[model samples]
Target: MSILSLQGVVAGYGSAPILNGLDLALDEGDIGVIVGPNGAGKSTTLKAVFGLLAVSDGCILLRGEDIANRPTESHAGRGLAFVPQEHNVFRTLSVQENLDMGAYVRRGERAALLDRVFEIFPPLKAKRAQPAGELSGGQRQMVAVGRALMSDPSVLLLDEPTAGLSPLYMSELFDRVVAVNRTGVTVALVEQNARQALGIATRGFVLAGGRMRFTGTGAELLADPDVARSFLGG
Candidate 1:
């Protein structure tokens, strides 16, 4: 069974729906990438699923349970974590402190979780004591993702993770995303770097005008000539 699925999801800022009957799914341990033009509702999908926006219609299922329109705070306990593109980390806090905030809902044995996140982000281990705002953009992005991982989620939602990143950092971040998936976390991410994002995706979705125009394995979508010409900057 799929780990997460959105069926005919309709959501928006006020009354105008940004996601118009949008649908997508991710299997266990899969790296699902959503790519498309600006205003295509790529980021909006993640927002809707993470409860940043209300689902006016349709269903969002997490491991077969209907979770649409649930309170945003309630999502973490249900094994869902979201790392938004902007203002994701607490600037004044130390790296370790930022990560600690992610586990606010947890009880004991937090050390192991810290170790796990540091293991994935070795640079964070060295700068754990430094203010999060002092770090470079890539490191900040890492902190944001690491903070989300502290929740130990089964499904992670990332919106435009590589936005404004240098090419080197973007490539490195993608490597880390693949590594994260290898550890059995189901990932759904919206990326502006379509070609590279799809390269690491197990499943790839091409969204246009708030709807899925194409869905396939990463390799399949990458190889599709039409996908290249229209969206991949052929």
Candidate 2:
């Protein structure tokens, strides 16, 4: 069964709807990448699923349960984790402390999860005591991702995880995203770097005008002439 799915999800800020009947799904071990033009509702889709935005229509399913419009605070207990593009980490907090905060919803120990995050991002382990703000952009992104991983979520949602970074760092962060997926957590991410993002996607979605225009394997979307000409910067 698909671990996470959105069916005709309509959501937006107040009166203006950004996602118009968006449909998406991800199975276990799938790396689902969403790519689109500006205002295509890519980031809003993540927000809708994580309860950051209210769903005015349709349903969001987590393992077959309809969770549309569920309270954001309750999403964590349902095994959903989201990492936004900016200001995701507490600048004043040490790296380890930020990670610990992600575990606030949990009841038991988090050592193993912390170790796994460190394993995925070795740089975080070395800088465990440093304030998140002191790190470079790429390192701070790592910390944000590491913090979300502390929740041991069934599905991970990321919005523009590679925004504003050197090419080398962007590549490295994608590698880390793949590492996170390999550990059996389903991942759904919206990315501005369409070409590179789709290259690693198990499932690729192309959004335009707040709806899915195309859905296929990453390779398929990359090879499609229309997708290339329209959205992939032909």
Maximum-lDDT candidate: 2
User: Could you tell me which 10 consecutive residues in candidate 2 have the lowest summed lDDT?
Assistant: 104-113
**Clash totals for all candidate models:** 0, 0
Cα displacement (angstroms), candidate 1, residue 68, comes to 0.8
The CA lDDT of each predicted structure is 0.93, 0.94
Candidate 2 C-alpha lDDT tens digits along 19-48: 989988999889999999999999999999
Clashes of 1: 0
lDDT of 1 at 13: 88
lDDT of 1 by residue, 61-145 (tens): 9999999889999999999999999999999999999999988766474788889888889999999999999999999999999
